[model samples]
Target: MSGTTWAAIDLHHHVVPREYAKALSKLGVTEGLGVQLPKWEASKALDVMDAHGIARSVVSISAPGVYFPAKDPTSAVAKQLSRAMNEACAALVRDHPGRFGVFATLPVPDVDAALEELRYAFDELH
Candidate 1:
């Protein structure tokens, strides 16, 4: 058996970019899951990864996803939020070189927006 060791890849990493956190704050969503959203720093993330021997991390938006104001069944806000998060992720990947990759969040229950975002993320962002 040829056993080759490779650096760890964290598939479930979450990065709440500074801009995204501000946007949420503007929307009055200060907390989710009964706790305030914690601050995140890209430099801190890299440090932790380095300490833990993780070479790459695929980042994604956390729970409750892009959808907000749950009463709005149209998912309009979800689409907008998803686009912002994806764009931010793309920027992070651009800035971090090989250290980060994106899972690409989609605005679910809104098929058309999701499809459009999928195309943009794969074609342009990647």
Candidate 2:
């Protein structure tokens, strides 16, 4: 494999958008899936990717997802959160060009809203 160059793609990457974190904090959610939430920053992620020789990473929100236990799964708040997160991911992609891609967030349990967000993510964001 001498002189070979590899462009790696990381499919399982997680991102905690700033706004999403704040929203979760406001809702008194400081952790997810029995672990403390990670503080994700784009510069740090990029540095790690460079060290790992990763050319691109497709990122999504981690556990606890978009549904808050205190709020109904079908609540508008979930939809709003999903939209905000997806938009944030899209921004990352836009800002980083080939370095980042988004695994769009959806408001699950709210079928209609999820579908709407899916369409928006693919059509508008992409």
Candidate 3:
């Protein structure tokens, strides 16, 4: 091997965007799948990535996805929340280009809305 090193790309990284956390708090959900949510900050995540020799991390939301409790996943609220989360992730990628990337969140169970978001995430956000 040559005297060169390559950094790793983490595809399964998780991120709890600020707006998403606030929405969850409003819904009285402090945990996901019965486990408490862990604190997250982009700076901290970047620091950890640097320490681990990770070149980039593709961040996405962790479970208890978009809808919560008895809320219908097809509802407007679900679409709105998904959009907010995706936008927040986009912002992270925007703020720290090359260091972060996004796995856009979709409002699942709402096919039309999901399609719309897919288009927006690709055409607009990209």
TM-score of each: 0.88, 0.93, 0.93
Find the 10 residues in a row with the least total lDDT in model 2: 68-77
Residue ranges of candidate 2 with Cα displaced over 4 Å:
1-3
In Å, residue 110's CA in model 2 sits off its true spot by 1.2
Rank order by lDDT, top first?
A: 2, 3, 1
Q: In model 3, which runs have C-alpha deviations exceeding 4 angstroms? A: none
Candidate 3 local Cα displacement, residue 91, angstroms: 0.7
Better of 1 and 3 by lDDT: 3
lDDT of each: 0.83, 0.89, 0.86
Which tens-of-lDDT digit does each residue in 1-126 have in candidate 2? Answer: 999998899999999888988988877887888898999999999999999999999999987788874665447778888999999999999999999988889888778889999999999998
TM-score of 1: 0.88
Comparing 2 and 3 on lDDT, the stronger one: 2
Worst 10 residues of 3 by lDDT: 67-76
**Residue 123 C-alpha lDDT in model 3:** 95
